[model samples]
Target: MSDPMNVLAPEHRRLRIGDAWRDAASGATFAVEDPATGKTIAEVADADVVDGLAALDAASTAMAEWAATPPRKRSELLTATYRALTERSEEVARLITLEMGKPLAEARGEVAYGAEFFRWFAEEAVRVEGRYSIAPSGGYRILTVPKPVGPCVFVTPWNFPLAMGARKIAPALAAGCTTITKPAGQTPLTMLFLARIMEEVGVPPGVVNVVTTKRSGEVVSALLADGRTRKLSFTGSTEVGRVLLRQAADNVLRTSMELGGNAALIVCADADLDVALDGAMVAKMRNIGESCIAANRIYVEEPVREEFSARFAERMGALSMGHGLDDGVNVGALIDEASVTKIDELVADAVDRGARVLVGGERPDGPGHFYPPTVLVDVPDDARMLKAEIFGPVAPIISFTSDDEVMAKANDTEHGLAGYVFTRDLQRALRFAEGLDTGMLGINRGLISDPSAPFGGVKQSGIGKEGSHEGILEYLDLTYVAIDLPGPARCSGRPACAPAPPGRPTLPTPSRSRR
Candidate 1:
């Protein structure tokens, strides 16, 4: 089927590497299909090891030059890039909607969120700070500074193509580290479009290269194994994250992974019923419930379980599901057949295990991969739908009585990326906020993916942080330099050392080491 909007009228572009666009090795191409229509929207290059090597080399050459450029200059470039993206956001949004099957409104919001990363990180470029210290007595002062960690290889998932790519690429560039990015083949158009926008906005070639490919594992392995890659940023399933971790370990390379999430929402007994019911409907169904941070499991207090369930069911039933391009559609399809199958399997497993179907179940009768917003009640603790991350428009609700019980149940999953707590009682809110084992928590709302906030997870959810000051640090290194004003320099062949003055400590010998 043809694309709904042939906005991408220009000829297909090749992968970006070293300030130039080049075709994939052997001229291999992969078909990119739009999930909403199950149609081949475009064919993108299937980047292989050869392409990966070229990208890495380009990034290596560009890193030092970019790092040495003034921070203000970097900020201005990023700002310009952000403006360009904003100007073309609607076009980008249509591309995302066409490829990912998210409603047009949600697609537009994702584009805006992606652009925000550029804006926020552009400011972060000038905010890096270092520490200054005084010597023990009257020796010399010590200074600490931050430096970019060279080139990084970034791989983002299909669920949130534009935002995820922005999350990694914006920070890497802002920190003065060049990047070679690989966007998921299933939904690469939005990001590819962004790369074009960057070029138009004057982001010099070689500094930020993007490649789209179907062979994720091979490309990722090639990137991680290369010694020149200073850092790796990945967002995907836990299984893939483990493999990347081991590969990065072999080279002793730095890695930041934002993997799977089976987030929990603890609805306390004293929570505001109206607010809880309203937020619950939106939190569990956002992105058609495909978000890694989407509230998958809801643990409601037994006392208010009945009322909560009723309100939740009413609100959920009101959600409209249809094609993303349709003006009245509220939720849309699971990316494709695979996702639809996965959601179906999980829902079936829950039903067979005795979970009550509170509302919409089974696939929506349509040509697309549309699934209705479903809510499962009386879910067994061991059900796959409850135990695993359900990346679909399904919410499985469970009941709990005590605070301790709910917290334990919430923390039971192997993954802990994000958690939500809704309570009017201040003490309970504070306690739950502090006690949730996830990397991030939302006290009353489910909004946790702020650009300024640190985003990541603990346990099997993922490694390292992805946003805010912590994120910049992941792409930077700290170095300490000490200059001795009164102490003599050690001879090239002589044993070193100046004994420190009265109460002063002596300086350690310098060894040339590269991080």
Candidate 2:
């Protein structure tokens, strides 16, 4: 059967502003190609600064009304959106595969995973609670309430397009903040379709806006300078994240950054080889190894290094590779030719530095931007793959002698997003888990991300968390209110009625500052 995305009408691929579809200010369009086939799937409107400002204005206008909407009402709307996404899961999944070139099955899984965020946060919305505390002095009460931060700008990346966008948008919307989603130019169609779903599911006009632009810097600058967007939630490269942080500093915008990751997968001598292999394969090669949390470095204990390397290379070599739409394809093409070039460069650097290629390394000579699932052994310390984020289907393995050596090597990078350890020894697992300088750890499993758990990183990986109960708080502001009630009458000669209790220390008098 032909690809579903190949037949997308031009109207189905326009900029979404509030409840309407529109053209770019410059009347320019950019083609979104299928990375698997190297074919142009659709041309979306290329939003400029003018279109970006319009989106910001729409989100700003909707912020007040959306924030005032009751928590239950917002929950209901989110639930409706969730249902809509679930119903159109196949369509959205296909779109994702066509644009970003993950396997169709993985793309479908992405849709399901992405929709879960909305469902989870729908339940989280009504559960947003305020705390009330009675003063020990017995006259005043303090209430801490959570309020929406205001209009937000979500800058999402192309990798795991649907899931990344959902992670940011679901929480922001659940917290009653209007959002202007700036989806990566390569994968805007999926988000545009989601915007359509939002509009159809009775999301009030101007509550959600999506703008796609090749000129992301200009658009982001405009949004930041406008002063209306109070929060900026971004998921992309650590370098771009730093740039965004500096840009946002001028406005002091509240930011939630889920940036780059160089996750380490540690295989111990006593680990279950089958489980370890399966987990490592999934962790390293999921989404063709484009994920930020994908295991980038593999450190195996010296005792089992040879056995593990042989089995891993054989399995990786045996896996199927083709276009995303093809059946039984285990891996798909990289997002673009640039990714292909970079992956080759990194592999060559590693091989030149004494790394041994066990299975695959070179890019396939084909029409698509395809790279084979590669495994390397004896990778040197100075290899570029060891230091850089290899956002591709290349797995480099290193051998370690001791627990301390492995731990030190695992935490050697600037990124601390995610890490994995495979060991049956409970004490060893716990020690490594505690010692690894990463935000999230998988003791025996390969995957770490879940809707119910907080997803983020430390060091240069990112700034704040996404998902879980804490996720909603990133989009909210804590406001404290003190209510003063009538107190006991003061003594005639004293300044106030209250005195020190029998065993308690006397409170210091707050002195007034002289002008």
Candidate 3:
């Protein structure tokens, strides 16, 4: 009934670059729509190549100073920002629900999850430990120092906008690196607000910047081409990831990509039927099934397939759907009409392949981009849904017989982001965990994401890890130094230093990019 966007002031609806919150240089603006009702909620500054390159310029100018700051001071600043974000969780949650259409309760949980990145990286800032080891040659002592990878550029997706930005920005700042980030065009408000919070918590001007733009390819290409911009971290589709990687090739820039996924959930015959059903709900329907790691294929053993599919279909049919801001709504709107269309096509394709819909299979006539919670049984292997990520509220359940057969079918896809298995026997659980061709696995439980653990994907799914200590490493470069044990005691105390070794060797790092 009310303007949900009243949660954000007019000042926060602009691009955050350097010390100014202003409109794009091109004077272009785009209206962001509310998916729940297809209403224009806000008109945001639409950045272009000029704004993006200007943001990069600011970061390059601030890089040396920010990287030279002491680790403890950086840690304190990040911690303060984390606290500041939590204080405004209610407002931030409202923005997320308004922009992305996730339930308000889930939006609050995202705020909590996102803020923890700042705190987690704050603790990690002071702990960027270097390594010391004796050289095998015995002529020199070897030590490696970790340093920031310099100014970085991040491209975030619309889903979980706050968390994705935080996951990238937190570690970059904690590692003493400056950054320029571009949020998804559809949902940039959270990141704009986050930039304000970081500024209030004492983030130096130009240390962090947010750019919202519809011309992402033009903007990102300019940033990547700039020699000063060192790394590019992106979270989106595998197709887009390949495009960005190709752009990265010309400059030889480092990249970290968390791309597409076709996750599978397997339930063994020995599993508790109730527990298996519950795990399926989480793995299938979290974020209304608009997740990169959301279970796309569900395989149940022959003995329990009937019972599990019946209960699952019943539960899926029972979910409540409405505007995310409404109370007691379990399922929220899809991102947009394109999302609804894609989900509908995937389901239709499966049904054409002889799959039977147990609950819902048709689109509703309404304003919002809403899809009913649907479950289909006997999903054929040749269906296109099995080969791709069905990023919606449709569940396609398939029956399996043996571990070998199931594993072959599960690993058949080109994407391998996450897998889940529920079994009472430890041996069977371990077998699935080991055999699954995925970066992360959930054993006997559905939930697997944790701020303290490493989160990433394998194959075309992603390039590097995103959480825990490994997350910080993405923003850092290691420099190995050798001290000449017998050759370089040649310090006459003239300049308070010893003479360097005769000749230095350049070390080659294994490239993560396929090119």
- Candidate 1 lDDT tens digits, 1-515: 23534655434356877777678886988887767777776887888888888899888888778999888988988899889888878878878888899998998888888899899999999998898876677477788989998889898888888999999888888889999889888887777777878887888778989887888888879988888888989999999888889999998888899999989998888888888876776678778899999998999999998888877887788888877878888898788887888888999998999998888886766577888888889999989977778898888889998988888888888999999999999998888878878998888886778888899999999889877878788889889988665554335553354444598676777778834
In order, the Cα lDDT scores of the candidates are: 0.84, 0.90, 0.91
In candidate 3, which residue pairs get closer than 3 Å at backbone N, Cα or C atoms, i.e. clash? Answer: none
- Runs in model 2 deviating more than 4 A are 6-9, 486-515
The alpha-carbon root-mean-square deviation between model 3 and the true structure, to one decimal in Å, is: 8.4
Best by lDDT: 3
lDDT of 3 by residue, 68-125 (tens): 9999999999999899889988888988999999888889988999999999999999
Q: Report the Cα lDDT for residue 421, model 2.
A: 96
Error of 2 at 103 (Å): 0.4
Candidate 3 runs further than 4 Å off: 1-4, 487-515
Candidate 2 lDDT over residue span 1-515, tens digit each: 56676434567578788767899989999999988878887889999999999998888888889999998999998899889889988888888888999999999999989999999999999999999977778788879989999999999999888899899889999999999999998888888888888888999988889999999999998998878889999999999999999999999999999989999999999999999999999899988999999999999999999999999999999989998878999999899999999999999999999999999997789799999999999998899998889998999999999999989999999999999999999999999978998999998898778989999999999998999999999999999999886575346666466566589787677778733
Ranking by lDDT: 3, 2, 1
Clashing residue pairs, candidate 1?
19-206
